[model samples]
Target chain A: MEQPEVAVAAGDTSDPLTGLRAVSSLRVLVESYELRQVEAALRAGMSWQEIADALGVTRQAVHKKYARRIDPTIAVPRRNRT
Target chain B: MSRLTDAVVLSQQIVVTATEEAYRVGHAELELDDLLVALTAVGGPAGDVLRSLGVTVDRARSAVAQVHADRLARAGVPAPPAQPRTLPRTGGGLPWSPRADRVLTAGQWDLRLVDDRRILRDLVREPSGFVAEVLAVLGLDAEGVLTALDAWVPTATAPSGALFSPDPRPWRTVTRRGWVPAAPAEVWSLVTDPARRTAWDPWYSAVEERADGVLAATLVGEAEGAKPVPPGFERQEVVPVAREEGRLVEWELRRPDRPGGAPVQRLAVALTPSGGGTRVDLTVRWLGVGGWRAVVGLLLRPVARLAWGQMLLAKHAGIARALR
Candidate 1:
C-alpha cells in the first residue's frame, strides 16, 4: 500500500488565494457532474417529474428546461409551483 | 559573523544524519522526516518536545519508511533499489533544497535564534512538507504541533547562550472569542450576509461581493466620537481569500501602497459548533511591518493590545445582540 502524502507543499500556504481557486474549480466540476447525471437519467427513460422529484425541483420546472431535449415531439408543459 | 555557530557541531551532525536517511530512501532532498530522524538521534530540547508530543525517532523513521513503501507499491517501483547508500548524497552538507532553506530561514526569523527546537517548530508547521507526511501518519497536523510548542516551556539551557532568549517582536496578535446563540450554519449566514450584517457590522460600512468570491468593502474606523483614521492610512480592499462555510473564514485587508509595498493584514473567523450555539473565534494579525511603524508598534504594544481588545469586545457584544 502506498502511503498518502499529507504534507503541505513547500510554499502551499504562502498565498491564501490558491485554496479559494481550488474550491471554485471543485464546485464547477461538481455542478458539471450533477448536470451529466441528470442528462443520463433523462436519457434512461426517466420522466421529467421523476427526475424533478429526485432533484427537489418541480416537475413542470424540469420539463420546461429538459423536455425538448428529452423528447422533442412532446409538448412543453407549464412549470409547477412548489 | 556566522549565526549558525551555536551548537554548530551538533547542527552539522544532524545535517549529516538527515542526509544519510534521505540517501537511504533514494530521495535527493533532505525532507522533514529526515530532519525528524536526525533530531531524534540528537536527543535534546527538540527531542524532549517531540517526546512530550508523543513523537519519537523510531516513530518518525517508521512513518517515513511506510510512506516510501506505499509510494513504491503504488508506482510499482522495485523494492529497495539496492539501497540509497549506493548513490552519492547529492549536494555536500546534506544539500538543502530551496524549500528546506526557506524553512530554516523562517525558523531563524520566527524563533529569533537558531536551535534544534526552533528548527523542529518550523519543520512541523509545513503541512505539505515531509513533516506533514509523518504527522499525518501520527494523526496530527501543523496546528497540533503549534499547540504543543506553545504549552512547552524550555527548561534546559539553550545552546545559543543567555542572550539568545526569544524576544518579543513588535508584532501582536489579538484573538477575541464570542458565543452566538445559534447553530454554526445560522451564525455563518448572518456573518456572511451583508443585509443581516447591517445590524452589527462594526468593521465594514458596505460589503459587495466581487467576482471570484472576493469582497470589496469600505472599512469602518473608530465608532462615533472616536479618533479619526490615522494619516497616510486609507480605506482599502478587503478580500475574503479563504472560506469554509459554517467553519472558517480568512480575509485579507490590503493597506495603502508604501515604498516597499502595501502591508496586508489577515483576519480569520472560526466557528466551532457548541451546544445549541456556536463559538466564534476571531483573530487579527498584522503582516508586513518594518521601519518606523515597527519601532512604534514595539513601544506601544500594551496600548495597542488594549485598544484591540476594546474593539473586539464591542464587535462581539454587537454580534451577541444581533444573534439574540
Candidate 2:
C-alpha cells in the first residue's frame, strides 16, 4: 500500500485551503509565533478594555474575536438523551 | 519494563478514586420531573428555594441532571467497560504494601476545580493551537505538536499529591504534562467523542459501545516489537464531570492482566479562558496495582511523561485539525 499524500511538498508548509503557504515547516511554526505579539499586547495583565484600545477594536469585538472559546458543551445539561 | 508498567498501573488507580469523589460529592440527586412537580406545587419551600437560587425549578433540575451525566461520561467510564470484562466498576485495585501487590496507597485527594479565567489564559488563536501547546509541553517537535496543542484544553482536575502532604502516596505521583491546544473546544470534541479516542491514544485498540450512553474501549500496546499483548485491557468513561463551553472530561482505564485480571486508571480535563486563547488542566490517575514509591516513580515519570506526551501531542494536533 502506498502512503496517502501527507503533504503537497516535503520542504514547505502550504495549504491549498489557507491560500498563503509557509516557505518551510519552520516558517509555518514561526508564523504563529507572531500571534504571541498580539497576546503580549492584550495582556500585560491589562484589561480587555485596555487591550481593545490598543488593537483599535471595541472591547466587545475583541472579547468575541480574541477571547477564548469555552467548551460550550461544558454548559450542556446532561440527561437521558432520548 | 515491568517496573514501568507497574508505575502506569499504580498511578492510574489513585486518580480514579480521587476523581470520582470530586463529582459524586458535589452533585444534586433530583431528576427533571421532580423539579417540575415542585415548581407548580409551591409557593412552598421548593419554589422559594428555586427562586432564591435565581433559577426556575425546571431549569435547575434539568441543569443538575445535565451536569451529572456530563460528569459521569467525562470521567471516562464509558471507554473501558464497553465490552464485558471482569474489571470492577469504581476502578482498578492498588495496594500500598509491596507484598500485597497494590497500586497507589490511600484515597481522598486535595483536588479542587480550576476557575474559568485562569484556564483561558493558555489559549492560542491558530487553528491548531491546542495541539501546538500540547507538543510544547510534551517537548515534541514544534511543528508536529503545535497542531495538537493549539487546540488543547483542560479536561479534569484530581487533587493529586501535587503538593507536599503527610501521606506519601497522593503527594508522590507521576508527572502528567500540561495539556494545551490552539482551541480548547476542539480538543474536548476530539477526546470526549468515543469514536475519536483511538485516533490519538497509543493504548486503546478500538472504541465501542456496551449499552446506552455507556462506552467500552479495548487497550493494546503499540510499542514496536512488543509481542503477546498483555491480558485484555479495557477503557471505560462514565458521566462527564463538566461539559459546557469548557469541558471537564472524566475517563477511566481497565487492565485485565493484573491481579484480578483487571486494574484501573482515570482522567479529567478542564479549560479556562485567557486573552484570545485558553488554559487547560489535564489529570490522570493510576487506580490499582500497589507498592508505588514516590522517589522510585519520580525518577521514571519525567521520561515516561515525555514519551506519552509526545504521542498525545501528535494526536491532539491531528484531531484538532480534523475538528476544524
Candidate 3:
C-alpha cells in the first residue's frame, strides 16, 4: 500500500478534525466488534444472562438490543423471562 | 413469463451482497470497496474472474481494512482492531453512496446486458477512484483485472442435450395436477399423439412427428389467448426421453434456433386412474443452464417459480377443457 506523503505525530490529538474522525471510526469499530462477539456467544449456546454478566450489563438490556438481530434458531431460549 | 432476465437477477444479488458487506463493518452507506468485497463472494463470471486472479474474500477483506487503516493513520489515529470474518445479518437496507450508485447504474447507458461482468467493468472505469485504490492495495490494477476477465472462459462443459436427463437438481421444476374426465389410457393416448396435443395444448399451434422420432411444433406466441412464447424462442422441438405406456410421457423441449448447450426445457405428463377419471400431473423443468445462470436462478427462484406456476395453470385448464 502506498503511504500518504504527510503523517501526523503519533498520539497527537491536537487537531480537532482528526480527533473527530478518529472518534467516529472508533465508535463504528466498537459497535462491529460488539455485534460479532454477541453473535459468537449466541452461536456457542450461551444464554443471554451469561453474555450480560460478561459485559457487566443487565440481561434484559442485552437481549433487547440483540434479540432481533440474531437468528432465532441459534439464539438461546429465555425461559419465563420477559 | 416474467421480464426478469438472468442479468437482472445477478445484479440484484450483487447489490444485496454489497449491502451486507457495508453492514458487516458498521458502515451506514454502501461504497465501492463494499461492492469490490462482495464481488468475491457472489458466484458469477465476475466473482470467478476475481477468484481466478487470487482475490479471495479473506484477502479482499484484509486489503479493505488496510485501506481504512491507512486513511486513519494520516489523521494521527491508530487503526482499530481487525473486523470479524462472520458478517452480521442486516435487517434493513443501507443507502448507497453516490459513487457506488454511479458505478452500478453506468451499464444502463450501453446496449450490453447488465450482468455481473458488465458491473465489474463499470467498477473498473468508475471515475471516483475508490475501487481503483482498493485494487492497488490488493496488488492488482484495473487494466490487468479487466484483461484477465476478458480472457477468462467459463469451464462449463456439459454436453449438448445432456442437461435434459431425469436429474431435477439443476432445473427449476413447476408441477400442476388436475383431474380430467377421461380414463388414464384415453388421456395418455391424446397426450402422446402430437395431432391430439395441437388440438388441446394452448402452447402449440401445429405439431408433427419428424423422421428422427422427435416432434417439431410451431409455438403459439400470444395467439388465441395462449401464454406468449418466451422471447427469442419461436419453435419448440420435443424429444421424448421417457415413456411408460398408458401411464407417463416425458419430453425434453429445445428451441430449434438456440445455440447448442443452451438449457433444454423438460415437459413430463404423468397419468393415473383416480375416481373414475384420469389424474394428470404436468411438470415443466426449465433453464437448466449450469454456470452463472444457475447462481442467478438460486437468487430469484421464487419469481421464476411463480411465473412457471401461472403458465402451468393456464395449460392445465386447456387440458381439462380438451378432455371434457
lDDT of each: 0.56, 0.36, 0.67
Report DockQ per prediction, comma-separated: 0.01, 0.02, 0.11
Question: Per-residue lDDT tens digits of candidate 1, residues A1-82?
Answer: 2323322321245545444433432332343344445556765766777889998999777666543222122222442321
lDDT of 3 at B178: 50
Which ranges of candidate 2 are over 4 A from the true structure?
Answer: A1-82, B1-182, B220-228, B234-245, B256-263, B291-324
Model 1: lDDT equals: 0.56
TM-scores of the models, in the order given: 0.35, 0.32, 0.44
lDDT of 2: 0.36
**Judged by DockQ, which candidate is best?**
3
State which docking tier applies to candidate 2: incorrect
State which candidate, 1 or 3, has the greater DockQ: 3
Tens digit of per-residue lDDT, candidate 1, span B192-254: 775665456566656677676666565554442224666545455666766765677767676
**Candidate 3 chain B, poorest ten consecutive residues by summed lDDT:** B156-165
Tens digit per residue, CA lDDT, model 3, B1-324: 122453554565567667766766756467777888777765457877887778877688888787667656665556555543443211245677787888788756555654477777888888755566678998999999999878877553221122123664656677755545466777877888877876567677789999998999888755433456776577778899888777778898888788685676888887766544555667889655668888897888899887876566556555654553
Q: Rank the candidates by DockQ, best first.
A: 3, 2, 1
Candidates sorted by lDDT, descending order? Answer: 3, 1, 2
